[model samples]
Target: MIGIADYLDKQLRDYGIKEDLSILDFGCGQGNYTIPIAQIVGGNGKVYVIDKDKTKLNQLLVIAKKVKVDKTIEILESEGQFDFDLSSESVDLVMLFNVSCCIIGQDNYPEFQKLIHELHRLTKKDGKLIIGIKEGKTMLNRVETGIPLISKEFKLDKKEKGKYLDGEKLRNGIFYSLTKK
Candidate 1:
């Protein structure tokens, strides 16, 4: 968790995720990134986290409580569906770090499209999306090198390669920042 916060604080700053901005951590698994996000965003900023794994969500809450960031963190439990409860153009940043294969990869392309469309709908016009993909993900091997085909709804503004938390250990990966088109 220590390295995660330091990494996120530096990475998120590039995306304008300072205090008082709203963020939605979609597909937030076990909240390895959520706790650090909560701290970075602080009390005024809201971190809305969504994950289908109830058990992991619960564990995240316990961790948040220990960090005294539970009040700033909001959980949106999913039912293995992309139908989120957030409103359109409501969030300043969408954190898709450590996303699952179900929403990415060639085989899950349809689901990937749906996920992007939904995330696009939820992101503010000026909001930024940061998606991190580890090596070996199906999409990472795509002809475009895992770059999403999102030019229609979002514009790929920046790409970064650095160390990110994959579960707990730090791993080198690529992440992109996309702004709504």
Candidate 2:
């Protein structure tokens, strides 16, 4: 059984994540991507993990400690809003994996737009924003509809379609690599 961290590592490498670059894992849940990202970034780089759930952040810290990469991971607790306290152009990579659709769903378009703008501000010039959405009817619909809005703030670099085994299920998804323009 492949773990989610391993799956995320493969996807990130496929999307061109390099070493010694600061990263931000927005909506990071339980450090799935955070740990791998920290490993990729090494000691010189940093991976900022942000999520609204404190419990999850704590779990991420423990995992980081267990992995002996806690120094490379910074945990931040969000207020369930797009308002982040980080400086502009502070990070080289920002990941919005499997969470953007929830922000842009039927009742959250405004929040989604706000997050897009905020992400743009947080990303360094030429930095990358990678968005991954699970390939499901509802999620696909939301991503397609939201792409236009997202394009206003980011230039779509490229996209890749793929699948990964998640426990007993094969989860199909698309990875959108967008650049700050």
Residue 123 lDDT, candidate 1, scale 0-100: 90
C-alpha local distance difference test of each model: 0.78, 0.82
> What TM-score, over all chains together, does every model reach?
0.89, 0.90
Lowest summed lDDT window (length 10), candidate 1: 137-146
Residue-by-residue lDDT tens digits, candidate 1, 45-64: 89999988899999999989
What's the CA RMSD of model 1 in angstroms?
A: 2.4
Model 1 regions lying over 4 Å from their true place: 1-4, 137-139, 142-148
- Tell me how many clashing residue pairs each candidate has: 0, 0
* Backbone clashes (count) for model 2: 0
Residue pairs in candidate 1 whose N, alpha carbon or C atoms collide under 3 angstroms: none
Which candidate gets the maximum lDDT versus the true structure? 2
